[model samples]
Target: MKLTEVQEILAKSSQEDWIVDDESGSFTYKNDLNLHIDRADFDSYREFNEPWATSHPDPHAVSVEYVVKYGSSFVDKHTLVSVDGHRATLPMPKSINDLRVTESDVNFAKIVNIGDRVDEYLKRARLVEVEDNE
Candidate 1:
């Protein structure tokens, strides 16, 4: 999805984005947050599993909850998980929603209220314009 579209969705959505600070110390969006991409039908939402859940549906592969498949930015102050601000600065065609990343990264940003209103918040932070959102 386009970055602007993601921002618009986030700006318009009623649900507050969730953040998960894993034991690994990496802060990410809700576990399996974007699991709704396709294939399954509300199964992921019903499970609402956390990263630490032992009985992941796909036991063969690394648990999607724990891995940094998406929402890879906003680890902690001064330490970035993905190069660009995961959600906010991510390259388009990312598997997950940019809005989700944007919300979480800004949620735990170095400064509070920065993610509350992304346009003004990111601008005030002086973060480089995420080309994807341009």
Candidate 2:
């Protein structure tokens, strides 16, 4: 992606709540969670917050709103149910690298697994064996 495009994504992501994704298809609360920690652990997250805040300054602090808008072609519209009972159209990136198509872009359509909740994805079954002697 072009520097401009990356800057746009960074701006938009900074505005909203962000979720972190592991390259291996897992999701987590921390951006680098998959690198050196357990997927279920978040105790260290707070330890990094202050340092992160100091190290990474907000781009918007410098009056850089232009860095957040993207071309129409890069975004996809999704209908979400609002609390007011109205369907709201939300703009989402069609691809991870929506600003520029890349070989590393994940094909969300193939992995979304719609209608399946994370609990359902985590459910498992155990097998039991019986012996005739018993």
Candidate 3:
């Protein structure tokens, strides 16, 4: 499979919300959740503002962490969802390197699995990208 084909599949499956950032050389999906994918390496995290502490007048206590939660803050603290193990490397054809299509690109099925993982992550995060009909 070619890189372009993979990009097209992700774009369609993600409702065109997944965009390729040429400068970063990675695919970025930003909605309520923010995801950055570089080759088989990807990072998923959410950003939100934490309530201000009583001692501090500032209310902009921003926090970022994986979407999945584990236990209470005093216990295990928030942890990553077990998406087939943390940072599970999605299968990709060896022909593809750094999101660039090599001359020997093949294995269409593996390329498709990459898209599947992306969709799965979005779903696991309680986010289903859908077209805005309005």
Q: What is the TM-score of each candidate against the true structure?
A: 0.20, 0.16, 0.21
**What is the per-residue lDDT of model 3 for residues 4-109, given as tens digits with 9 covering 90 to 100?**
5434443344424545543443444444233334432234432222111111233222221222111211111122122333222121212222222221111111
Give the best candidate by lDDT: 3
Angstrom error at residue 132, model 3: 3.4
In angstroms, give how far residue 41 of model 3 lies from its true place: 14
- Enumerate residue pairs that collide in model 2: none
Put down candidate 2 lDDT per residue, 13-71, tens digits, no spaces.
32112343433323221232221111222231122122111222221111000111123
Error of 3 at 126 (Å): 0.2
lDDT of 1 by residue, 21-131 (tens): 323334322333641111112223222122212122332211122222224332212212211122221111122222223443343232212233434424432343333
Q: Which window of ten consecutive residues has the lowest lDDT sum in model 2?
A: 59-68
Clashing pairs in 1: none
Task: For each candidate in the order shown, give its overall lDDT on alpha carbons.
Answer: 0.28, 0.21, 0.29
Off by over 4 Å in 2: 2-69, 85-134
